[model samples]
Target: MLSVYVDLALGLTVSFLLLSLLVSGLNEAVVRLLSIRSKFLWAYLRDTMDGSDAQGRSWLPANPGEVFAALPFTRDPRPQHSDQPSPAQPGELPEREDKAEDAMVKLLYQRVQEIDHPKSGRTSIANIPPGRFAVALMELAASEPDGVEGFLGKLRSMGSPLYGHLKGVWETAQRDLDRFRQGVETWFDGEMQRLSMLYKRYVKWVVAVLGLLVTLVFTMDGLEYAKTLLRDNALRASVTAVAGAGPGAYEELKARCGGDDPVRCVTETLSQPALVTMVDHALVSVSFPAEGDPVVRWNGGAWWDRITTPSHWPGFLLTYVALLFGAPFWWDVLRRVTGLRSRR
Candidate 1:
């Protein structure tokens, strides 16, 4: 019994440790994968900016005057054409072109601002050309700064080389991001498979454990009956007489003792095989108390002296009933820990 208890304890401990390790490993893998994905996304965005066409050009400034001053229009102004109809006035025409250009400029300026001081508002700037937006962005990239600083300072420091480096980093990060995404997909797939396997394994273990427990319970019950026999002199005498009999004589004696109370009559008449076999079968049917039942006690005396009444059947039934009821809860916990029910 002591050896059986040790074996059961060891098995449970090992199972618990294995379950813990599997769950922890799955969690760590997922967290690390997410972290890598976040970094990859950041790198991809930076690279996209580097590859843009506005690297070394000025688009718009927080102050409109600064943008107008930065433009090359002042260096080489177009001659006046008196014959052509004057460009429509802002109030007369809707200024759609200017507004569009302003929006683009603002967008570019905001990008630069984000690269510099991340907290800057993403307001759109105006007065940018449509066809040259990409090129202007590449040129403006040079204005961004090298190291971390405020928004404008960062914009002023970015150069062509820096843009190229950022582009390279972006490409690398994109590849890594793709690979990481694939890895996560693969990992989740594998996790589902592993969780299924573990659940099946645990179910199998539960069935085996429960079966063993039932068998042990029944066997202990039989042992209890044997102990009872030791106290019942008539039953013990009947068993002893049966142990000393031959099969033919026992059959004749059983036939002669047959009656309404055949088992009792056999014990009174044959006091042998017929009586002992009946007693053994009766003993086998008796139920054992559950583990935590109050009836189970250590008397600190002879081992066989410990005896219990049949009143604790309810406790035994309740214990197994509770275990059966807890199956759903265990299943839910396993699903949550393994992310089995989560959508990708």
Candidate 2:
């Protein structure tokens, strides 16, 4: 009797673990398809250069999106823009409204559109090394006819907040280019940390939505599965055996597929026989409606009930909540439980 409960516990854990992996895989594919990382990175750069907050509220005296557009790093170096002004042409001071800064801004905006939905080739890089960014910025400042000091004067005349920021960095570096680059790198790193937090928050919502969808599609009713496991001795023993057989494969999969490389992890792990078998068992445990067809027709039942009977709601909710705990959480639990069983 004690062993029966143990098997029931193990079976549910295994089921949830498999479902979590499926959700994780789908989440990765969705993220990649949407180019979410690239969008976040671009947003960060835009906010910084435009002197605006995340909500586009400006706190700075002057916008530097124009200055940023002048930098070569933001524009693609390909042949399509061969006839355009050289990115290094910042040496030529602003002419008129028709030819100088306005044209560059238009070109940069076009580049942004291309980045968001490219007709061909990969998306714009989601990450830029701090060192590379620092180099491009410093070189832009140095490219002026009178050099860095002259560039600072132009910014000061315009009451640009970026001038004050870079002036402090220049002073801290004591007029040394290498030290200035290093200081900029440190500043860029701090900004990247904030971007990382924002990206994580975005990912959390993706996980929540994806988990709910996967749970509903699989009809994974936790309470029903628990009742079945408790009542059927043969089914309980079989699930226990499968659960016991899984640890070796689980460890191998964990090592090969880590949190860092989610795309490859999803591609490889979902193809394994161990995961496939677990998913089969999970489907077998699903509870389908015995009365009217839940899909095609609805009788006098309440609108909500037509979606899922009241009795199954708790189980569906439970399964979805468990999935929100994520694959790594269940993986850890599974490892510890198997270790205890082995010792016994």
Candidate 3:
């Protein structure tokens, strides 16, 4: 009986975790689809490339999109303006000779070639050096008459977190061009690391908040489920039997929920999974409390009466906290619990 109880608890907990993970993964998918993180990075990169210190001058394109569109790092560069004639019909004419979508190549061939090196009095973007991205951008920033000071002023305008940290380093190394260049590169690297950390932290908070909302909707009262099992012998047996074999039902779970990746998961990518399916399965295998059992019919008037009752709030709270532990953590617990069953 005790083993059965343990199995029931472990099985249900694992299910809850899996469902929670599905929710969390979908939430992340929404964020990625909206390109929120990319937009932030794009802003950071924009400030770096297009920033100007001169009264009205900049060596690079002003728009972040345009800058990325003109870069080799990007896959689809923007098309450049051309004087070539256009084909009138579909499949009626041969391919156009001008491939203006090579914005980056045109940039390198034209703009980079137009700028003269302050020291060598020569023009070249590729010949500057083959190294880090930040180093290359800094060299471009220096292509203008104002030089390194132009880049420094741009960083200062943003009031970036690193700006304060780099104050002393900048002051000490400003005289040596090599050291100043290194310091700027270090600053860029630090900003990216900080952004990465903040982005991770943001995702965690999203999970917690989304978990709370999902638990409420599912009416997953952990206490109610526990109480239902403890006091009813028939219900306990049914749930225990199902749960003992729950590990074997993993393929069914996957088939229902689809693949692990949220993108390929069942149903809509961002829409919440039919959590009512989870609730129904649990109730069928476990049954509700005797007084509240759906089979017996009661004055409560609705099926959710079993969950929406104020008495179940505490259990709901527990479930909410459990959800925050995430799928990975619960998966580990489920593995250990099932391993013990196999051993016995």
Which prediction has the highest TM-score against the true structure?
A: 2
The reply for model 1, stretches above 4 Å from the true place, is 1-182, 190-237, 243-310, 313-344
C-alpha root-mean-square deviation, candidate 2: 13.7
Q: Across residues 1-344, which tens digit of lDDT does each residue of candidate 3 receive? A: 68657756765766677767877787778664444444344333333432332333332334444332333133211223333332221111112332122222233223333322221221222222223544554454455356655544544554433345445556878656788677766766676787666556656766777888777655677776665444343333433454667654444444444446322442232232223334642323233443665452232334457556788789788888888888877877887776743344
Q: Give per-residue lDDT, candidate 3, residue 294.
A: 43
Where is model 3 more than 4 Å wrong at Cα? 43-133, 145-182, 227-278, 281-307, 336-344
TM-score of 3: 0.49
TM-score, every prediction: 0.18, 0.60, 0.49
Give the range where candidate 2 is weakest over 10 consecutive residues by summed lDDT: 96-105
Compared with the true structure, what per-residue lDDT tens digits does model 1 show for residues 1-344? 35434433333233233333434454346434333222222222233332223243322122333322332232111111122222222111112222221222233343333222111121121122222333333343333343112222333233222334334433544635334334434433454455445434433443444533432232223333333333344434444566797775455545545523446664444444322322232213322334544333332332122213354344334333433433344455556544568457
Which consecutive 10 residues in model 1 have the weakest lDDT in total?
88-97
Which lDDT values do the candidates have, in the order given? 0.34, 0.58, 0.49
Error of 1 at 44 (Å): 30
Order of candidate numbers by TM-score, starting with the best: 2, 3, 1
RMSD after CA superposition, every candidate:
24.6, 13.7, 16.5
